[model samples]
Target: MKKVAPPQCLQNAFEENGLTQIDVFEFPEGTHTAVDAAKAIGCNVSDIGKSLVFVTETLNPILIVMNGADQVDMNKAANLLGLPIRKAEATEVRETTGYVIGGVPPFGHAKPVETLIDKKLLEKDTVWLAAGTPKTVFSLSTRDLRDVTGIETGVDVSA
Candidate 1:
Protein backbone atom coordinates (compact mmCIF):
# COMPACT_ATOMS: atom_id res chain seq x y z
CA MET A 1 0.00 0.00 0.00
CA LYS A 2 1.08 3.57 -0.65
CA LYS A 3 1.43 6.16 2.10
CA VAL A 4 -0.81 9.19 2.09
CA ALA A 5 0.47 12.73 2.25
CA PRO A 6 -0.67 15.41 4.65
CA PRO A 7 -3.06 18.03 3.39
CA GLN A 8 -1.44 21.06 1.80
CA CYS A 9 -3.47 23.47 3.86
CA LEU A 10 -2.26 21.84 7.05
CA GLN A 11 1.31 21.67 5.81
CA ASN A 12 1.34 25.32 4.75
CA ALA A 13 -0.21 26.41 8.00
CA PHE A 14 2.34 24.55 10.06
CA GLU A 15 5.20 26.02 8.07
CA GLU A 16 3.81 29.56 8.08
CA ASN A 17 3.23 29.33 11.83
CA GLY A 18 6.80 28.11 12.47
CA LEU A 19 5.62 24.88 14.00
CA THR A 20 8.88 23.10 13.32
CA GLN A 21 8.25 20.52 16.00
CA ILE A 22 4.94 19.38 14.62
CA ASP A 23 5.23 15.93 13.04
CA VAL A 24 2.37 14.52 11.05
CA PHE A 25 1.62 10.80 11.38
CA GLU A 26 -0.61 8.70 9.21
CA PHE A 27 -2.55 5.61 10.31
CA PRO A 28 -3.71 2.99 7.89
CA GLU A 29 -6.87 2.22 9.81
CA GLY A 30 -7.93 5.85 10.28
CA THR A 31 -8.17 8.22 13.24
CA HIS A 32 -11.38 10.03 12.65
CA THR A 33 -12.60 9.74 16.24
CA ALA A 34 -10.87 10.47 19.52
CA VAL A 35 -10.92 6.81 20.51
CA ASP A 36 -9.42 5.81 17.20
CA ALA A 37 -6.68 8.43 17.41
CA ALA A 38 -5.84 7.55 20.99
CA LYS A 39 -5.60 3.88 20.14
CA ALA A 40 -3.36 4.52 17.16
CA ILE A 41 -1.06 6.91 19.03
CA GLY A 42 -1.06 4.95 22.32
CA CYS A 43 -2.08 8.01 24.31
CA ASN A 44 -4.86 8.97 26.63
CA VAL A 45 -8.04 10.09 24.95
CA SER A 46 -7.82 13.41 26.76
CA ASP A 47 -4.54 14.05 24.99
CA ILE A 48 -6.38 14.33 21.69
CA GLY A 49 -7.33 17.90 20.85
CA LYS A 50 -10.67 17.65 19.14
CA SER A 51 -11.36 20.66 16.97
CA LEU A 52 -15.08 21.42 16.88
CA VAL A 53 -16.95 24.11 14.99
CA PHE A 54 -20.07 25.86 16.16
CA VAL A 55 -22.28 28.67 14.95
CA THR A 56 -23.14 31.56 17.18
CA GLU A 57 -26.67 32.94 17.35
CA THR A 58 -25.74 35.65 14.92
CA LEU A 59 -24.46 32.96 12.49
CA ASN A 60 -20.78 33.57 13.10
CA PRO A 61 -18.32 30.71 13.24
CA ILE A 62 -16.52 29.65 16.43
CA LEU A 63 -13.86 27.01 16.84
CA ILE A 64 -13.55 25.06 20.06
CA VAL A 65 -10.44 23.00 20.75
CA MET A 66 -11.44 20.63 23.49
CA ASN A 67 -9.97 17.51 25.05
CA GLY A 68 -11.24 14.28 23.53
CA ALA A 69 -12.39 13.06 26.93
CA ASP A 70 -14.56 16.13 27.44
CA GLN A 71 -17.85 17.24 25.97
CA VAL A 72 -18.81 20.80 25.14
CA ASP A 73 -21.53 22.38 27.24
CA MET A 74 -23.31 24.48 24.66
CA ASN A 75 -25.11 26.57 27.30
CA LYS A 76 -21.93 27.28 29.23
CA ALA A 77 -19.99 27.96 26.06
CA ALA A 78 -22.70 30.31 24.90
CA ASN A 79 -22.59 32.09 28.23
CA LEU A 80 -18.83 32.44 28.02
CA LEU A 81 -19.05 33.88 24.53
CA GLY A 82 -22.17 35.89 25.37
CA LEU A 83 -24.01 34.36 22.46
CA PRO A 84 -26.26 31.39 21.95
CA ILE A 85 -24.41 28.64 20.16
CA ARG A 86 -25.18 25.48 18.25
CA LYS A 87 -23.15 22.81 16.48
CA ALA A 88 -22.40 23.52 12.86
CA GLU A 89 -23.77 21.15 10.27
CA ALA A 90 -21.42 19.20 7.99
CA THR A 91 -21.84 21.60 5.09
CA GLU A 92 -21.48 24.64 7.32
CA VAL A 93 -18.30 23.26 8.90
CA ARG A 94 -16.69 22.48 5.55
CA GLU A 95 -17.73 25.83 4.06
CA THR A 96 -16.46 27.85 7.01
CA THR A 97 -13.20 26.05 7.76
CA GLY A 98 -12.42 24.52 4.39
CA TYR A 99 -11.94 21.17 6.13
CA VAL A 100 -14.14 18.25 6.96
CA ILE A 101 -15.41 17.57 10.47
CA GLY A 102 -12.82 14.89 11.35
CA GLY A 103 -9.94 16.83 9.78
CA VAL A 104 -10.31 20.37 11.08
CA PRO A 105 -7.27 21.55 13.02
CA PRO A 106 -7.21 24.21 15.70
CA PHE A 107 -5.78 26.71 13.28
CA GLY A 108 -4.88 26.93 9.59
CA HIS A 109 -8.42 27.68 8.66
CA ALA A 110 -9.35 29.18 5.31
CA LYS A 111 -10.60 32.17 7.30
CA PRO A 112 -10.25 33.30 10.87
CA VAL A 113 -12.88 32.19 13.30
CA GLU A 114 -13.36 32.93 16.98
CA THR A 115 -11.38 30.27 18.88
CA LEU A 116 -11.55 28.83 22.36
CA ILE A 117 -9.21 26.36 23.98
CA ASP A 118 -10.41 23.96 26.60
CA LYS A 119 -8.59 24.32 29.91
CA LYS A 120 -8.35 20.56 30.28
CA LEU A 121 -6.11 20.29 27.23
CA LEU A 122 -3.67 22.70 28.86
CA GLU A 123 -2.96 20.16 31.59
CA LYS A 124 -1.26 17.84 29.14
CA ASP A 125 2.33 18.31 28.02
CA THR A 126 1.49 17.18 24.50
CA VAL A 127 -1.67 16.72 22.49
CA TRP A 128 -2.51 15.28 19.09
CA LEU A 129 -4.77 17.00 16.57
CA ALA A 130 -6.13 16.17 13.13
CA ALA A 131 -3.81 17.13 10.30
CA GLY A 132 -6.44 18.09 7.74
CA THR A 133 -7.25 14.42 7.19
CA PRO A 134 -8.97 11.71 9.17
CA LYS A 135 -6.05 9.33 8.71
CA THR A 136 -3.45 11.85 9.79
CA VAL A 137 -2.57 13.75 13.00
CA PHE A 138 0.20 15.85 14.51
CA SER A 139 1.59 16.45 17.97
CA LEU A 140 2.39 19.68 19.75
CA SER A 141 2.93 20.86 23.28
CA THR A 142 0.21 22.72 25.11
CA ARG A 143 2.19 25.94 25.23
CA ASP A 144 3.29 25.64 21.62
CA LEU A 145 -0.28 25.07 20.59
CA ARG A 146 -1.36 28.28 22.27
CA ASP A 147 1.55 30.21 20.80
CA VAL A 148 1.15 28.94 17.25
CA THR A 149 -2.62 29.16 17.23
CA GLY A 150 -2.54 32.63 18.84
CA ILE A 151 -5.14 31.49 21.30
CA GLU A 152 -5.05 33.30 24.61
CA THR A 153 -6.03 31.79 27.96
CA GLY A 154 -7.94 28.53 28.10
CA VAL A 155 -11.55 28.35 29.23
CA ASP A 156 -13.90 25.95 31.01
CA VAL A 157 -16.33 25.33 28.20
CA SER A 158 -16.42 21.58 28.56
CA ALA A 159 -18.37 19.31 30.85
Candidate 2:
Protein backbone atom coordinates (compact mmCIF):
# COMPACT_ATOMS: atom_id res chain seq x y z
CA MET A 1 0.00 0.00 0.00
CA LYS A 2 1.16 3.51 -0.70
CA LYS A 3 0.86 6.48 1.61
CA VAL A 4 -0.95 9.57 0.43
CA ALA A 5 -0.38 12.89 2.15
CA PRO A 6 -2.74 15.86 2.00
CA PRO A 7 -1.75 19.07 0.18
CA GLN A 8 0.92 21.13 1.91
CA CYS A 9 -1.33 24.16 1.80
CA LEU A 10 -3.96 22.26 3.74
CA GLN A 11 -1.55 21.14 6.44
CA ASN A 12 -0.22 24.67 6.59
CA ALA A 13 -3.70 26.05 7.04
CA PHE A 14 -4.12 24.21 10.38
CA GLU A 15 -0.52 24.77 11.44
CA GLU A 16 -0.58 28.48 10.72
CA ASN A 17 -3.73 28.84 12.78
CA GLY A 18 -2.18 27.04 15.78
CA LEU A 19 -5.06 24.58 15.74
CA THR A 20 -4.50 20.95 16.61
CA GLN A 21 -2.89 19.06 13.75
CA ILE A 22 -5.89 17.27 12.34
CA ASP A 23 -5.19 13.56 12.21
CA VAL A 24 -5.90 12.64 8.65
CA PHE A 25 -6.72 8.99 8.00
CA GLU A 26 -6.22 7.39 4.63
CA PHE A 27 -8.59 4.77 3.26
CA PRO A 28 -7.42 2.71 0.34
CA GLU A 29 -11.09 1.96 -0.31
CA GLY A 30 -11.76 5.68 -0.88
CA THR A 31 -13.87 8.23 0.99
CA HIS A 32 -14.93 10.34 -1.97
CA THR A 33 -18.68 10.12 -1.43
CA ALA A 34 -20.34 10.77 1.90
CA VAL A 35 -21.78 7.26 2.10
CA ASP A 36 -18.42 5.77 1.32
CA ALA A 37 -16.83 8.02 3.90
CA ALA A 38 -19.25 6.93 6.59
CA LYS A 39 -18.66 3.27 5.79
CA ALA A 40 -14.94 3.69 5.97
CA ILE A 41 -15.15 5.59 9.23
CA GLY A 42 -17.73 3.30 10.84
CA CYS A 43 -20.30 6.01 11.38
CA ASN A 44 -23.84 6.77 10.36
CA VAL A 45 -24.18 8.58 7.05
CA SER A 46 -25.73 11.59 8.81
CA ASP A 47 -22.59 11.93 10.91
CA ILE A 48 -20.46 12.54 7.85
CA GLY A 49 -19.88 16.10 6.80
CA LYS A 50 -19.95 16.64 3.07
CA SER A 51 -18.51 19.85 1.78
CA LEU A 52 -19.96 21.03 -1.51
CA VAL A 53 -19.15 23.94 -3.80
CA PHE A 54 -21.97 25.92 -5.31
CA VAL A 55 -21.45 28.81 -7.70
CA THR A 56 -23.77 31.77 -7.43
CA GLU A 57 -25.14 33.59 -10.49
CA THR A 58 -22.56 36.26 -9.76
CA LEU A 59 -19.79 33.64 -10.17
CA ASN A 60 -19.03 33.64 -6.48
CA PRO A 61 -18.30 30.32 -4.80
CA ILE A 62 -20.05 29.28 -1.61
CA LEU A 63 -18.98 26.25 0.39
CA ILE A 64 -21.85 24.42 1.96
CA VAL A 65 -21.19 21.81 4.65
CA MET A 66 -23.99 19.29 4.58
CA ASN A 67 -25.06 16.10 6.29
CA GLY A 68 -24.33 12.97 4.32
CA ALA A 69 -27.92 11.80 4.40
CA ASP A 70 -29.44 15.01 3.07
CA GLN A 71 -29.43 16.77 -0.28
CA VAL A 72 -29.37 20.49 -0.76
CA ASP A 73 -32.68 21.98 -1.82
CA MET A 74 -31.59 24.42 -4.49
CA ASN A 75 -34.62 26.64 -4.14
CA LYS A 76 -34.27 26.96 -0.41
CA ALA A 77 -30.56 27.50 -0.67
CA ALA A 78 -31.01 30.26 -3.24
CA ASN A 79 -33.62 31.91 -1.08
CA LEU A 80 -31.25 31.79 1.86
CA LEU A 81 -28.27 33.00 -0.08
CA GLY A 82 -30.34 35.64 -1.88
CA LEU A 83 -29.07 34.45 -5.26
CA PRO A 84 -29.54 31.62 -7.67
CA ILE A 85 -26.79 29.03 -7.51
CA ARG A 86 -25.76 25.89 -9.27
CA LYS A 87 -23.26 23.18 -8.60
CA ALA A 88 -19.84 24.37 -9.63
CA GLU A 89 -18.14 22.78 -12.59
CA ALA A 90 -15.21 20.56 -11.78
CA THR A 91 -12.81 23.14 -13.12
CA GLU A 92 -14.55 25.87 -11.21
CA VAL A 93 -14.44 23.82 -8.03
CA ARG A 94 -10.71 23.29 -8.30
CA GLU A 95 -9.96 26.84 -9.32
CA THR A 96 -12.07 28.48 -6.64
CA THR A 97 -11.39 26.05 -3.80
CA GLY A 98 -7.99 24.63 -4.60
CA TYR A 99 -9.60 21.22 -4.24
CA VAL A 100 -11.32 18.67 -6.41
CA ILE A 101 -14.98 17.77 -6.06
CA GLY A 102 -14.85 14.78 -3.72
CA GLY A 103 -12.51 16.42 -1.26
CA VAL A 104 -13.55 20.03 -0.74
CA PRO A 105 -13.10 20.76 2.96
CA PRO A 106 -15.53 23.05 4.78
CA PHE A 107 -13.03 25.79 5.54
CA GLY A 108 -9.61 25.79 3.90
CA HIS A 109 -9.56 27.41 0.47
CA ALA A 110 -7.26 29.17 -1.94
CA LYS A 111 -9.26 32.28 -1.21
CA PRO A 112 -11.71 33.27 1.48
CA VAL A 113 -15.21 31.98 0.66
CA GLU A 114 -18.54 32.39 2.36
CA THR A 115 -19.57 29.11 4.02
CA LEU A 116 -22.68 27.66 5.56
CA ILE A 117 -23.24 24.50 7.58
CA ASP A 118 -26.47 22.55 7.46
CA LYS A 119 -28.44 22.46 10.71
CA LYS A 120 -28.35 18.66 10.72
CA LEU A 121 -24.57 18.54 11.00
CA LEU A 122 -24.57 21.25 13.63
CA GLU A 123 -26.64 18.89 15.74
CA LYS A 124 -23.90 16.30 15.77
CA ASP A 125 -21.25 16.52 18.47
CA THR A 126 -18.59 15.29 16.05
CA VAL A 127 -18.49 14.36 12.41
CA TRP A 128 -16.00 12.95 9.97
CA LEU A 129 -15.20 15.06 6.94
CA ALA A 130 -13.00 14.75 3.89
CA ALA A 131 -9.44 15.82 4.60
CA GLY A 132 -8.62 17.61 1.35
CA THR A 133 -8.56 14.38 -0.67
CA PRO A 134 -10.97 11.78 -1.87
CA LYS A 135 -9.25 9.07 0.15
CA THR A 136 -8.59 10.88 3.38
CA VAL A 137 -10.74 12.01 6.32
CA PHE A 138 -10.60 13.57 9.77
CA SER A 139 -12.87 13.97 12.76
CA LEU A 140 -13.64 17.31 14.37
CA SER A 141 -16.14 18.64 16.85
CA THR A 142 -19.10 20.41 15.30
CA ARG A 143 -18.42 23.43 17.51
CA ASP A 144 -14.83 23.61 16.27
CA LEU A 145 -16.05 23.18 12.74
CA ARG A 146 -18.46 26.06 13.21
CA ASP A 147 -15.77 28.21 14.74
CA VAL A 148 -13.34 27.41 11.95
CA THR A 149 -15.81 28.28 9.23
CA GLY A 150 -17.01 31.35 11.11
CA ILE A 151 -20.60 30.36 10.50
CA GLU A 152 -22.30 30.79 13.84
CA THR A 153 -25.61 29.36 12.76
CA GLY A 154 -26.61 26.54 10.46
CA VAL A 155 -29.09 26.88 7.63
CA ASP A 156 -31.93 24.59 6.67
CA VAL A 157 -31.02 24.02 3.05
CA SER A 158 -31.60 20.31 2.80
CA ALA A 159 -34.38 18.80 0.81
TM-score of each: 0.94, 0.94
* Clash count per candidate: 0, 0
Candidate 2's TM-score reads 0.94
Off by over 4 Å in 2: 1-4
Off by over 4 Å in 1: 1-4
Cα lDDT tens digits for candidate 2, 1-159: 234556777777667656565788889899999999988888899999999999999999988899999999999999999999999999998998898888887777888888889998999999988878899888889888877777778999999
The ten-residue window of minimal lDDT in model 2 covers 1-10
> Which has the greatest lDDT?
1
Alpha-carbon deviation at 35 in model 1, angstroms? 1.0
Q: Tell me the tens digit of each residue's lDDT in model 1 across 1-159.
A: 124556777778878878755668888878898999999888899999999999998999999999999899998999999999999999999988889988888988888888999988988898999888788888888888888877768999987
- Report clash pairs, candidate 1: none
Cand. 1 Cα-lDDT: 0.87
